[model samples]
Target: MKYGKTLVNDVKTTLKVLVLFVPLPIFWALYDQQGSGWTFQATRMDGYIGFYTILPDQMQVINPLLILIFIPLFTYLIYPAFAKCNFLKTPLQRMVCGGLLTAASFGISAGVSFALEATEPSLPTEGNCQIRIYNPLDCNAILTAEPYIKNQDIKTMGYTNLDIPNVYGEKVVDFSITGCDGKINYQTGSNLSVIEKETLFYYMLPDSFVRGQDDIERDENGLPKIRTLVNKRVEDFNLTYSDSEKDVLNLPSNDDSLFSINPGSYKVQSFPKELKFYLGGVYTVLVSLDNNNDVQNVEYYEVTQPNSVHILWLIPQYVVITAGEIMFSITGLEFSYSQAPVTMKSVLTAAFLLTTAIGNLIIVIIESAKIFEKQSEDFLLYAGLMVLDMILFGLMAMKYKYINMEQNSDNEELENKSERKESNAIDNPTFKHNDDDA
Candidate 1:
């Protein structure tokens, strides 16, 4: 320790690193949302790109994949250009630039979210009910419901959405579908009790099936719910799960039956045909007759549109955030190691990592407090916070003295030696007498 001279330098270096830790957790809090907030965002968007569909959970892979590509690109090409321009000369500058990019990425996400809010459909308000009809038959069908929706012609395989506010709750209403030149005149006065803020999906199937009882249970995890309404007698009805589990499901003829299953791809095999189910969905499948008026098919419809905003909108945000990570995350670690004293390198690294935990804690606290009304607003708030954080970090960096540990150690050794020589001179009476005579 050179009689504590080196220890002073080491302590100072440690304090500087600790100061850098202040703004770091905010970055981590925003970055770690790839698993939670970002995934939830993907769920509201459409995952279809060409023929392949991307899952919301799979979006997390974009970070690591971009890291692999960005590491080399920055190391070999991008950083060199910046170096030539006399830019980002220090690790601190790169980290600041990276933080700005992080803020920019979230800004882009906010814009996408605003677009989603505009394009996506809204749920029925309190005391109001929404309904959509699906016509799977080949012939065009005319739907009629007095005092709620006008007589509209729904084309073959097309659907129409209607919103009704307090349409005689628990009271029966006359609803009819006419097609096939009036050969198919289906009428019903059943009380389709579509409660307030609930969506009822009705499919006009060519089968003699009665409306089944409604199962009122809702899933807490927000997983998908599937309900099968058997209109006719069918055999070998089953659901084939992607996780290699198959169950022989049977719905009593002309009754409402409900079943809950995990979220994944599932194939429903029955007498009519096969239908595939997606994740986090609420679906109702009705067994019905084909255009032949003979029971031979089943159709399923969802309560809400699963993918209205395309997943591709997320790509730009992901790219920007990944680039920022490549610049900020990697440079921060390097700076922490290089500036730390040799004996405390590992401790500073651990301190740098602790910022991530703190960032997550901030998120948990704010979420529990319900500080924001909308997620877009929350994102904007984070972006704003990050900007302020970067400003503070940049100011701190300007004051931080970048030191070479080896050079500092040598200087400390020289200072210690000089101090010892001065002490010896003061202690020796002959040296003091000679100095006094001179």
Candidate 2:
């Protein structure tokens, strides 16, 4: 069934639609980051708000939540106001504004990233050793190291981090721990090699001390790595997570070991410690004892404090992006349908979706390239790309002739009805004889 009359025109219209769609993928690429890049950014931020805590992944809810609010707000208030101003009169104009807002959202994110980077702890330089001490004793402990740290006071049940000269093979650094009065209690006079560019954590416990290398490996998706430093007293412990159970056995007195676990709230049985773990975090759980040698409490230390930057800073970016989504994505689809030829609606819709998939592919390519060392740089780069894409889209939109498919369909239907009536009168012999008699 070939409709030869409209075939050429439909093909020409479809080609124009494809040209207009060329820049849409970039918009989707930036918009889709609310799930990936934005969520990851939230993971490193503090989620506490008064009495309630918002998880990093839960930040995505803001998009949909705002969408519901924005849809009615735009329909009733915003669009009406814009109409009076003679702005955003067409879908193309709305989509262009949407793309601009998307770029602006990334600009906000980049600003936030710059702020966060300033507060973030600096990584150890090559040929340097970064060490943090966890003193779980009832009294404060003063640590003295030769040739580097003179006297650093690590408070009771608290930790202090320091960077020192790296000790390579065949050499050892002397370390002494004492009370506040400078009375030496523990000393490491033997050979202890410290690696450069690595973080070493020392746990001070009752009757013994343990030291382990910090594992800064991030959790991918929902799998987080948990390193448990069990006090010698607790023989075995069972961890009940949200989905599974992990039983740790026979760890040495005050010894720490690292293992991966599903991210969730964990209940440590046999010692009664309930804790919640977030995504992409490397955690150090310390089970300490009191003066009476009984189980004191459980302590948690994250290698990189994921909750340092506050999550509320993300609100501005989210708001802008959601607004952009309402404008760019929805309006783009609407524009595609309205401009499409009668028989080409389905094909254009599929092409619109294909642009979204291509946008995601762009993300993969950028991520794999490892172009930027800092996340802030990555955000700025995306923003720049979005601006460039919007410029191209705007140029295409200017040249695009808006075709009213509904009006054409209505006229075609009217013509078909008129033709049927004419045929009926011509086929009637009585009407022809009446005309001949008249």
True lDDT of residue 27, candidate 2: 93
Backbone clash total, candidate 2: 0
Off by over 4 Å in 1: 1-3, 131-162, 166-195, 200-225, 232-282, 289-295, 415-438
lDDT of 2 at 285: 71
TM-scores, in order shown?
Answer: 0.74, 0.76
Task: Encode model 2's per-residue lDDT on 122-241: one tens digit a residue.
Answer: 666777887777876566887776765678898765778777765453235677777833322445443333667777777765555566777564544434567765444444533323
Note each model's CA RMSD in angstroms. Answer: 6.1, 6.7
Clash pairs (backbone) in predicted model 2: none
